[model samples]
Target chain A: MQLKILYFGMIAEITKCSHEILAVETKCNSNQLETVLKKKYQQLQSISFKLVINQNIATKTIFLHPDHEVALLPPFAGG
Target chain B: MHKKKTVFIEGAITPDFIANSIAKHQTKKSIGAHNIFLGQVRADEIEGKTVQAIEYSAYEYMAELQFHTIRENAFEKFDLTCMHIYHSMGVVKTGEVCLFVFVSAPHRKIVFEAIEYIVEMIKKEVPIFGKEVFEDETHQWKMNTV
Candidate 1:
């Protein structure tokens, strides 16, 4: 499965890309994806962020799907 | 149930634009009360420097999804006739509007509650970020603890 991931705010600065497509197994969940990303980019391990799957914020157990728009987002500061 | 909304992840929301939006809603005879919440960029002295603007960013897709969900939830929880929410994306200068939430209902009570709920949800659930820019161009990220 090819998942498109978006990085926002400071996360984008750290990741150095706004969005990217990664090929992973269809059975991979949010946690698995996070682990894979952390292994690739070690700085991700120190930041607090949320995983949004298909435009919705999801828990670590949320399953991945092909073409899902996933975002690695940091905490909100909007008033 | 209201018409599809206008959602923008822009630089700053202007006062004239907001006034125009309010004027456009004048035809709604059923709405008696409207409550609006405007979030402004504050100039504060932090670390011996003054803040100039806020560079805003968001998880665009997820922010829209959360905003839609917040809209639906507000309609379910309150008797609102209409609602509007807009937030800034890039550099919003100090004293400029960054976020605006407007809600209308037949009475004052529901409008008040709906607007508050909408703003709260946007603050807590949406994946928006603010980077505070100083006069010297140095920046510090804003973190919301709650």
Candidate 2:
């Protein structure tokens, strides 16, 4: 499956792009996606971020689909 | 259905804009108290480099959704007459207001609590990012501390 991954804040800085499309296994979960991303961008392993799937934070190992909007969000600094 | 509120401003939130918002509320006769929280960009010295401004960005779609959720939750938890939230996008210089949260209620206590709750949630939940630009133009991403 092809997933659209969004990068924000410091995560974007490391990724060098705001978003991209990555091809992964059809049955991959959030944790597996994170591992794939870390392998692709080794610097990502050093920062803390959360995986947001379809506008909600993915707190557990949720399965990913092609249509799901996936995002990597660094720590929030809003007020 | 509740209409989505506009939360992102292009630059610093001017005092005039804030005054106008308060002025527009004059006809809300039932409101007995109004509490506001303004977040100002600070010129903090980080490793000898002074912050000159903050360039903010966000996952705008997600941010609007989070703001809407916070607003709905606030209305559910407090007896608020109305509330407004505005945060700066792009660049906001040091000493400028970056965030403005206004909450009004029939009584004073509810407004106070509501304002705090709304501000806290915005800080923790919104996917807004701040890049602190230093005097030399170097930047560092800011993270909210507990």
Candidate 3:
């Protein structure tokens, strides 16, 4: 299955792309995706971000559902 | 259900607009206290360059959802009469108001706490982005370190 990923704030700056669709195999959890992302984009390792599934923040150990809107959210600076 | 409230404004929020908002509330006899929090764009000196302005952006749909949720939670936890939140979109110059949070209640205590909590939650949860543009025309993305 494929999951659509979004990058925001400082994470988008490091990744140099805002959004993309990444293909991941079935039964692969969120941890595997994080590792793959860090490996693919080495700059991502330097930044801290949250993984949001369907607009809700999730932990690294959480499972990824293909139907959800997945995104990488950097720390917010809003008031 | 209440109508959808606007949380975003084009470009920057003006001091005059904020003053007008405060003026509009002057006649409310039930409001014993009105607490407000305004976020101003800072001119930060980073890497020997000074920031000139900040460009703001957000995932609007998600931001609206988050704002509504915040409103609901605040209303539940506090005895507020009304609340309003306004944030700028696009370019906002240094020293300009980027965000305005207003809370009114019958008394002073709850308004203060509610305003603080709402501002804190917005900073932690909203999908807003800021790009710091320097005087030299160079720019860098801004993020919360906490």
Candidate No. with top TM-score: 2
Q: List the candidate 3 regions with Cα displacement exceeding 4 Å.
A: B1-3
Candidate 3, B93-114: lDDT as tens digits: 9998999999999999999899
Tell how far residue B57 is off in model 1, in angstroms: 2.2
Deviation from native of the Cα of residue A12 in model 2, angstroms: 0.9
Candidate 1 stretches with Cα past 4 Å from truth are A23-26
Query: Measured by TM-score, how close is model 2 to the native structure?
Result: 0.98
Instruction: List residue ranges in candidate 2 displaced over 4 A.
Output: none
Sort the candidates on DockQ, descending order. Answer: 2, 1, 3
Report DockQ per prediction, comma-separated.
Answer: 0.70, 0.90, 0.60
Q: Number of clashes in every candidate structure?
A: 1, 0, 0
- Per model, kept true contacts as a fraction are 0.79, 0.87, 0.66
Ranking by TM-score: 2, 3, 1
Question: Which digits, one per residue and each the tens of the lDDT, describe model 3 over residues A5-79?
Answer: 988777777778888889988876788888888898897788777787877777547777778787887767775
- List per-prediction Cα lDDT, in the order shown: 0.85, 0.94, 0.86
Candidate 1 chain B lDDT trough over 10 residues, lowest sum: B1-10
Clashing pairs in 2: none
When 1 and 2 are scored with TM-score, the better candidate is 2
Worst 10 residues of 1 chain A by lDDT: A51-60
Candidate closest to the true structure, highest DockQ: 2
TM-score of each: 0.88, 0.98, 0.91
